[model samples]
Target chain A: DQQVKQNSPSLSVQEGRISILNCDYTNSMFDYFLWYKKYPAEGPTFLISISSIKDKNEDGRFTVFLNKSAKHLSLHIVPSQPGDSAVYFCAAPLDTGANSKLTFGKGITLSVRP
Target chain B: DAMVIQNPRYQVTQFGKPVTLSCSQTLNHNVMYWYQQKSSQAPKLLFHYYDKDFNNEADTPDNFQSRRPNTSFCFLDIRSPGLGDAAMYLCATSGTGDYGYTFGSGTRLTVV
Candidate 1:
């Protein structure tokens, strides 16, 4: 069974518009969430993350919102640029202790058309 | 500068041959992880090392094994690879206090 789910396989947006990618998790024990971005032939880079204690965290033009009650989280990128086209993955640690290791969701491919 | 480095970038091995992939981290993070990713799929954790303690995922195949000789180096050894083992292998590291992980450019393995 998948612990994290990115039901949407892909998302397309026009340049300078807002792009929203959604993710859901079945495990309630997850208290920390992270988002990663990847380009072709490259490793996934850390984007942004939110502790369950906070409902949202923003970094530059990227914002991540978490809804613990709903077991869902969303990433929002405003003024999306062509360079933003890549795969986005949502992840959470299996536990919040010292041995925390992440469990990733199937990535969502984002295409920003200019 | 890359904090994590994976060697060979690409590797091709014949069926039943043993292969070893290496990863080194400059960050000196306390934790190291090995993850396997098939095409268009999520990265699945195979194992990890917390300092000298090695932890393996329950579902990881016996064909796969890992060794962490020290704080900065980790190795993945495939005893006998099969065609189905072809995939991108990723290495990552994180400090205990940090929630975000730094990943190395994966090594793509092609088993023939």
Candidate 2:
């Protein structure tokens, strides 16, 4: 069973515009959510994260909004740049233990057109 | 620069042959994890080591085994590789309480 799901396989947006990627989860025990950006042949780099207690978190051009009641989260990039193109993964922990194991979505490929 | 390092960016092994993938971390993190990622698929957890204790995923195949000799090094041993085992292997590290993990570039394994 896929606990975390990224419904959209890919997204395209014009440069200087906004790009939004959505993710959903069925597990209610997950208290933290994180987004990672990956480029071709490279490892994933941590982007932004949000706790269940907070509805939103932002880092520079990246912002993550979480809705605990709906078990959904979205990542928004404003004024998207061509360099922002990459695969984005949404992940959540299976449990809240000291050694938490993360479960990731299939990932969404984001393309920022110049 | 402290980082997670995975050796042999690429490897080719004959079917039914044994192969070992190595990982090391200079980050001095307490936790290390191994993940297997097939093409166009999400990374799957194989196992992890918290300090000296090793933990394996229930679904991980018995053909796969891991060893952490110390805090700085870990190894994944495939006793008998199959064609379906071809994939990218990732190593990650994190501090005790930190939820954020740093991952290596990953090693691509090909079973011919």
The model with the greatest lDDT is: 1
List the candidate 1 regions with Cα displacement exceeding 4 Å. none
List the pairs of residues colliding in candidate 1: none
- Looking at model 1, give its docking quality level: medium
Question: What does candidate 2's lDDT look like per residue over A1-114, in tens digits?
Answer: 899999899999999999999999999989999999999888898999999989999999999999999999999999899999999999998888545878899899999999
Q: What DockQ does model 2 achieve?
A: 0.65
- Where does the lowest 10-residue lDDT sum fall in candidate 1 chain A? A93-102
Query: Mind giving the per-residue lDDT tens digits that candidate 1 earns over A1-114?
Result: 899999999999999999999999999989899999999878899999899999999999999999999999999999899999999999998887644899999999999999
Relative to the true structure, how large is the alpha-carbon lDDT of every model?
0.94, 0.92
Q: Pick the candidate with the highest DockQ.
A: 1
